[model samples]
Target: MSEQSKSPQAPDRTPRVVIAGAGMAGVQTAVALREQGWRGAITLLGDEPHQPYDRPPLSKAVLLGKADGATLDVDFPGLGIDLRLGCRATALRPADRLVETDQGPVRYDYAVLATGAAPVRLPGTEGLSGVHLLRTLDDAERLRPELAGRRRIVVVGAGWIGAEFATAAREAGCEVTVVEAADRPLAGALPPEVARYMAGWYGDAGAELRTGVAVASVAPGAVTLADGTVLPADTVVVGIGARPATAWLAGSGVALSPVDGSVLADERLHTSVPGVYAVGDCASFPSARYGTRLLVHHWDNALQGPRAVAENIARGEAEGVVYDPVPYFWSEQFGRFVQYAGYHGDADELVWRGDPAGAAWSVLWLRRADGPDAVAGAGRLVALLAVGRPRDLAQGRRLIERGALLDRERAADATVPLKAAVR
Candidate 1:
């Protein structure tokens, strides 16, 4: 049998590709496939009844009521893909190359798992209508009315969602109390100094920031602290974090990471099984910056990863480019726009470009020292974190790996471009 003859010939029909989860990654995958001239029948399965929409805005604009939830509509029919909304995908059988959903079994030549993550609900708080989690448009819609009553809103966990919710609650005239077991906000992502600066933001925003305190329990009227101190709350918003929605993949031969239950993928986002790929919040791949497998649950990664996967899926091993874009994320909290680009886990030194106490400042993390204040090469400015400075983030992203020690006097000028700090 020759190379082409040894294999059973594929049917002379458009390849059927079923994508589970209609989030950003899945929708974009469908769009990219069609745009790449993939004539295959694409079926997008979403557990939610609504169309795909940008999720980042949910915690900020949607919660603040500055944007309506209904305005979120991703044109699916315009892309000529079958949209199966409000349906759940039950299982995947790689041997059969078919996905079992509530509607029926969907056989496919290729399948994508962009299932995304599920909000972690605090145990014992279920059935309490006041308790909420912000992961979906519907979740934001349900919690908006509670914001208008000036209620005491207890935000559990001080991660990005918690901080954003605290900001929105304060804007809604509600008393916001943030409880975090960590010593500072964003302790997992930012340094202690930077985290402390953010801790002060809650107080400055007129919201209570309680650090190093574990949430013992949530009652109807209050949140009980670890020390038995009760914080009155009419609404408790849980932002503890998210776990991958890979429950359906159990016993399906797809390897998932034990660390966080994320699907393990190579640079091309291919799972252990061939012909199937994973991306977005559900998958983790080795990152050159961190030198280990990392799970980046950000908007840009979800939006951009599909193109790489689509090319690989369409052309197989002939596709050369591996998915290795710089990781970036942003947040709006306490009337400030915080943006971070690159990863700083291994940075040797952290330098502030501006006064932290001032209205605007950005910090650049340099991995290597090229003499006194010069660091160059890739991964040098492994990460740049900025507060209230979007343009600085844009400039710093380009300056990263440039090996230039920032001059505070020059940086304070406010006239220097972020990339020109050293140049």
Candidate 2:
């Protein structure tokens, strides 16, 4: 008999998808898959015992006691998702298509890695009481009482998390001091000239902003600067940064980014492993539009990346779905609503909108191009940072997606609507 004639017909069965994390990305992936009409089995695994929750609130509402909890508004049982809370995925066995968890190895037809990121802890601060890292509900909860007591807080790193934490600490009547190793606040995220204006917000909020200061060591009640400056603190919050939580994928044959250990996912969110996909903070996807691989660790990325992942999984490669997105994120700090959209690189031209020292202002970043029309090319809006200017951010985001060429003077005019600036 011919090989084709001898082949047995395979029985049709529902696909099983195992998601390794139960944070926003993991939960959203499961929800999106179901909403996309995938009647497959979904096993959502999380290391935390608490129910899946939104993380953004952990820094704002939850920390300020404005909200009780950030638990996600999802009925896991009703959705028929296998919500495995408090279960840790120890390793990935790609050869057998199984996720080795503390509970047991769970088999899957396809697996989605949404492990997310872990907060970078301050060195030599381990086992020290009153030191915390805010990345989860438990971390926020632990810090809540400290804030309620109106303790003196020394926040390390003047990044988003640190600024937000300081805002909350000040609101809670705590003495706040933000220490950054860089020369200005948001040094890693914004230009010094832009970040210089933001530094004033800390002082306006009654928090001391100390930049270009390195922490030599962190103790229970104080942080010692490299210059031997001892900053008194009843509580210390480390907000330096976070790294992708992909240590479990070691030896699993999954290709991880050498830069940040993020899973190297394609434009479609598929990992090096044939049957596996990665999304959110734990995954870095290449953006053909930006000509770079972006590892966006924000709520928007988590919310948006899932749609592409789910579609590709459901419709397959023929769908040609890509996960390239205009990166957007917002932060509430010093009584200001700060929003940013799109990717910006060194080559992007920075255009100022309105007075930076004023209560409301925005910054437009245009992509640089060469040629006779270089001036017009440089006016192509690619990214925007709006401080207390939501309309600018809202309009700028749309214009960026449209690849709108803007007039520099009109784009920088606070009186003009960003959409109208496009020529």
Candidate 3:
């Protein structure tokens, strides 16, 4: 082949960043790229046909039909983002820098894995009628009518989603019964002393909360317990848990955590593979602040991670910024405003600000002490949870970030400001 006869070189195309999911993390990544001064071609792919929306509302307002939808207020065209709906990425070919989607192969200069998570389903209930999950817009829409009909709902799992869904169902006049296999609500999340305080919220809302009771089987119109006790259920809402949607990256040269299947990103949100990054529920990063690997599945993590990923992408690898945030999240359930900040371990010294049975109370987790700043044998604030006390949460979150040591006696005084309690 003569040099002159050789195929003409392909035209130089604009550099592109392909985002795999259109959830909060993916959408924000595309937006943040522009904000971070990345003037490149951005292509975002979403499996759902509807506009990308918030997930938290799916369990609350959307489930009760109080709102039509919770679509994000981002303008894709205005932002120069090519948003492709109903196009799911099936595989990632790192060698070719191509993402194989259900639609077609999409080329990318860089790729972001923000596919979020998939809710864990009950065994043998894939196609069973009256069984549903509240993870997506369509899922919420399908469940709205069910809740509006005032059906007897049996929610499996007394986790955050279960409690929130029960709140919505009860608000809609449904007979809500939440069954948990553990000994208490949020056994997987909070310590028993704290979680025990929440168990009363369900019964107060007229919903039967059955803890330490395993579901032997789940069928339409009923849920059978391990003890052979059958609870009448018109509908079954499964909120057991969710696993990161990182299975598509298998063999794509991305390291995934065996514990949770999340992409094992470094401190800078960059994955094992060059020119590729991961964020949101699909990714777990080492938290030097917490001294452990953190897998955050909440909206806040999904909201905060993209900014770091975007900034790192805009700046070259050498100048990338580190991502180590003080993780925060809030929950509105059981007619109370609940907030939590920082990470706490069972070994932490537990301090009560007020009576747990009271309508408004807060609990602070202090590090076990012998430090110079130790007060009452506790050192530094590790974590804090407040029920109907936004002030404590707001002030304590900052203290946790600053690693402040709280004067135990002052912090235990419900009237004292958390900042004042800092030693």
Candidate 4:
């Protein structure tokens, strides 16, 4: 195996950093440690036998066969990092600072949990041949053949994954039908008005969008609706939502949210247990910028959170950095590029730029203020949603980070640039 020597100034005995889960977050933590000059024995363990790869493309590019797998670009042995593939972590022993894996127990000076989230599977759909959940490379490979053939595809849930899957299926000339429990598409993520507008995108793409429809059951060659309607489907795709992958840490003394079972990590991404931290979908970190704890299950979080974890482990607590990032994610569905940045809440004032019914539009979520004078000084740009507008998202992210105040009228004007809306 290739090896890199430790720094000359460093002590002879180096600390060992163990990372659980070999996904984007886990692998990034290992690389960040080395990049930050942490000359430790980094052990990266993954349950999957395949090489570490990106998950976002699994629904779009990989599913459509436009490209192959998007694997992580890192030389494992060359970096002096031990990458143990196909090793599932069974339990966490915080007191012993060891992780119990299928292979054996692995010890570490610092442990980072980045197990990531699993796709929500439909009940009674297990063992079904045509039923699928697209989360991993293997899952995509299994569903790709179904898309290649002419088949009736029924996608459950109108979330990002479902929409993208439907888009791909339609592009492949398959008969597509999307079923959503809510009255509008993306009901959990977007407002009803915005979701209503997005619902039309399905028809535009030649896919039938059925909202307010719940799946009664899934069987061979069909999906039964709650209203006693049977939709003929050769293949069924479920993309409801995902929860944090923290079941292994049940008795590990790490604090987890009772509502969603997410690891309650601090601003520094540290778990309740000492020398143990969590990031990515498995952990929820408090954000002072948004005035709440955010459980971000996107690519950006997995990419950025690891840097903070490495800083705390390498530089010590006094020099540790805080991770309060403006949550960002993008989705390509129904021939539209949808982008969102920053955290939005009910208290934020909704400012619409351009027309939501039009081809291109954006929404600015300004933090609510008390009085009229507050508009000039207190109504900060908290969040932004842009459809087919990349520049708005690009500029709004920076403005949101600086807590920039905005003039309401200027922000509402579609002609004005987002940066110029600042008071």
Best by TM-score: 3
Full ranking by TM-score: 3, 2, 4, 1
As a TM-score, model 1 comes out at: 0.91
Output the number of the lDDT-best candidate.
Answer: 3
Superposed Cα deviation of residue 9, candidate 2 (Å)? 20
lDDT (Cα, tens digit) per residue for candidate 1, span 307-370: 8888877767575348876788899888888999877773456777678888798887766545
Candidate 2: which stretches are off by over 4 Å? 1-13, 372-378
TM-score of each: 0.91, 0.96, 0.96, 0.95
Backbone clash count for every predicted candidate, in the order shown: 2, 0, 0, 0
Give every collision pair in model 2: none
lDDT of 1: 0.82
Q: What C-alpha lDDT do the candidate models reach, one value each? A: 0.82, 0.90, 0.91, 0.90
What is the lDDT for 40 in model 4? 77
lDDT-superior candidate, 3 or 4: 3
Instruction: Report the CA-based lDDT of candidate 3 relative to the real structure.
Output: 0.91
lDDT of 2 by residue, 1-423 (tens): 211234437532457899999999999999998888778899999999999999999999999889989889999999999999989999999887789888877778889999999999888888899889999898999999999999989999999999999999999999999999999998889988899999999999899999898999987788899989999999999999999999999999999989999999998999999979999999999998788999999999999998888888877768748877889999999999999999888778899899999989999998756777677533788899999999999999999888888988888788999888887
Residue 49 lDDT in model 3? 97
- In TM-score terms, candidate 2 sits at 0.96
lDDT of 3 by residue, 303-354 (tens): 8899999999998778878999888888999899999889998789889998
